[model samples]
Target: MFKKLLLVVFIAAISCTKNDGFQPNGDVLSIIPLEKCENGFAGEYPCNDYDLLDYISLEEIGGIGTKGNDCWGWTDPLDNKEYALMGTNKGITFIDITNPTEVVILGTLATRTVNSSWRDVKVHNTVAYVVSEAADHGMQIFNLEKLRNVTNPPVVFESDYDYTGFGSAHNIVINKTKDYVYPVGTTRSGTYKGGPLFINIEDPANPIDEGGFINYSHDAQVVTYNGPDTEHQGKEILIGSNEVEVVIVDITDKSNPIKLSAISYSNVEYTHQGWFTEDFKYFILGDELDELRKGLNTRTIVFDFTDLDNPVHHFDYSGSSAAVDHNGYVKGNTYYLANYTAGVRMLDISNIENKTITEVGYFDTYPDNDMAAFNGVWNVYPYFPSGNIIVSDINSGFFVIRKSGS
Candidate 1:
C-alpha cells in the first residue's frame, strides 16, 4: 500500500536494527504518570489535552528487533474488558488493557507466514482477521475469546483459522451488520485485481468467497448504508481508497456489484486511507504521500456523500504540523488520527458542517519531529467504549491514552 515503495524499502533496510537496545518479553513496564499537557509537553512528549495512562515498548510485547505496525481494539462483550490487538513484525499482540496502568501482554499470535513491516487487524464477533503485505501471508483468523484465559503471559498462540483465498492483503474491511469481510490490496493479478474480495465470515472460521471488485483498492471502509442519501439507505456499500481516486461501489448484491462512482482530488499523491463519519455523511481521506509530495502540513480531505453518485469535495483540513497522516477513525463528533511522527491527534468534527475542525487533544508518542515521514504512530483505534484510545506506534510500540479530565 506504500506509494513510495523504494523509500520504505530504503528505510526498512537501514532501520531494521532500530530496536537493538531493547529485549523481547511479555512483561508490563511501569505506568506513565498521569500528567497533562503543560506548555506543549506532557512530561517528556508533546501533547495537548490528553494524558498517557500506559506505554509498552516493543521489547515488552513481542521482542526487540521487530517493530509495530497497525492496531485495533476489542472489548470482550461478556466482561466488558478492553483489549488492544496490536500488529508487529512478529504477529498480532493481545494486550489486556482493562487496567491501563497495569496493562498486560497476554500473548501473541505468530504471523502465518513471514515477518513484514505492514500488517492490519480488524475484529468481528469475537474474532479478529489479520492481513499483511508479506508474501503469502493470507488472512489469519483468531478467536479473540482465547485471550480471556491467557493466564500464562508471553505464550505464543496460533491462528484458530486461516483463509488462503488470497496470498497477501494490505488491509481488511469488515461490514459487521452484514457479516461480511472484504480483503483489499490483494495480489494485483488475482480475480479481483487487488480490489475488494467479499468473504462471508458469518461463520467466523470458515470464510466463503462471495465475490470481489476488479478495481485495485489500497484500503476501504464497508458499511450497511444509512447516511444522508436515502435512496441507497440500508444497502451494503464499499468506499475504497484507490491509489489515484476514491471509488464508491455498491456491494449490496455480492454476485453483481455496481461501481457507483469514482472521484479524485487536486494535488493527488496517494489515496491511502479514509473513514466515514458516524452519520456516514462525510468521508475523510488521508493521502499517504501528499504531505511530502505537496510540501504541506498534515492534510485531510473531506467528501460530501449525501449523493454518492455525485459526491463532491467538501473541504480540506490542514493541521499545524507537517506530519504524514496514516489511518483515522471517527466516533460521534471526534476524529482520532494516527499522525506519523506527529503522534495521535484528536480533532473535534462537530462543526464539520461549517467547514471547521479543531484539534482537541493529542499524545505524541514519537516526539522526534513532526516531519512528513512514516516512522511513528501507524494507526489508532478510538471505538473502544471505555474512552481509552489505543495507538500503535511504529517505533515505540503501543500506548493507551485518555482525555486529561475524562
Candidate 2:
C-alpha cells in the first residue's frame, strides 16, 4: 500500500474514464496456453522455475484505468472451487480459476464510491469484504456463494451487504479464528485515528462496530497467537506496519486492547506490509519506498519475534532486482512476493531462522525493465488448495500462475 496522503490526492484528482493513452490488447475473453519456464523464459515473460498458467488483460476484464492494487483468493466451501478476487481502481473483479487453462471472469462489483486507484479485498467464511481509498467507499461485503448463480458471464455484480459505519479504508484484515474483521487505515481524524476497526462480523451481513486500535496502520496481519510466544499464545495479536514502525497489540479484549510493543528498522522509508513465518518466531517485512528513495535492491527485513515484547531485527534479504516490494504472503516455507516491477518472486525461507533465504522461482508479469517503480504485480494469492497462484498487476489485469512441474 504506497498510499500516502499526497499520492492519494493526486490520483483522486484524475478520473477513471479519462484515458491516459494506455490501451490494452486482450479485449475479448480468451485463454492463454500454458507456458513452461524453459531456458529462463516463458513466452515473452522472464522466469526461473515458475510457469504461466494463464493471463487476462485489463481490457478483457473491462478495466477502464490501468490501476489495480490488491488481490485475494476465495475457495468455495460448497465445492472447493478456487476463485480470485482482484481489486481494481473501479471495482473488485471475481474470476473462477478452478481450471487455470479455462479461466472464467465471474464479474466485477463496482466500488462503493468513485474510483481512487486503491482497493483491497479479503475473504472470510464464504463472504468477501472489499475496501477502497475513494471517499465514502465503505466496506463492501459480497456473498461468495453467489458466484455460482451468474446467469450471464462477466456482468456488473453487486455487493450483498454494504456497511457504511466507516468510510474509505486502505486494507481489510480478517482473523477467521474469531468472529471479527479489522479495517485499518480508515478515514483519518476518526475516533481511532485511522487505526484498525474491530467490527464483529459474526453475521456476515450485519457487521457490528466494536472498539478498535487508536493508531494509523498502513497494513497488518492479525493472528490468534498460536506461535512461540506462550505468554500471549491465545490472545488476538495484531502486527501492524504503521508507516515508520511496526506496532504489536493485544486485541483479545477489544474494550481495553493493550499495546504489546513497537519496533523500527534502519534505512526505513515506509513500513509497508509484513507476514509471519509458519512458526511466528520471525516476521518478514517489506519497505515500500526504500528501493526508490534509498536506491536499494528490493529489500525485505526479517525480524526475530522470539520475544514479542522486545522484537529485534535479525537480518535483511535483498532481491535480485531494484523494484519495490508491494505485498508478500507466506505459504508454508515459500515467501510469495509481489515485486512491483519484477513481478512475483518465490523465496525459500526454510532456513530463515539461520539468516539464509534463497530465491526459488519467479514469473515476471511486467516484461519491461525492473525499475524501482510501482507498475507491476500488485498482489499475489497463493493459498489456494490447487497450488495455483493468482497475480494482480497494475498495468495488466489478471493472471494465473504456478511453479513449473508442480
lDDT of 2 at 165: 95
Model 2 misplaced regions, further than 4 Å: 1-33
Per-residue C-alpha lDDT of model 2 across residues 109-201, encoded as one tens digit per residue: 988779878899888888998988899989999988899887889888889899999989999999978888899999779999999999999
* Per-model RMSD to reference: 10.2, 10.8
**Model 2: colliding residue pairs:** none
**Residue pairs whose backbone atoms clash in candidate 1:** 24-63
Q: lDDT of each structure?
A: 0.85, 0.86
Error of 1 at 387 (Å): 0.6
lDDT score, residue 349, model 2?
A: 99
The digit string of per-residue lDDT tens for model 1 on 1-406 reads: 0011111111222332322111112122233335556788866789988877777888887877879999999877776678899999989999998766557898889888889998999999899999999999888999999988887897889998889989999999998787888889999888788998989988877889898999999999999999989989999999999999999999999999999998999999999999999899999999999999889999999999989999999999999999999999999999999999999989999999889999988899998889888899998888766567889999988888877765
Roughly what TM-score does model 2 have, to 2 decimal places?
0.91
Worst 10 residues of 1 by lDDT: 1-10
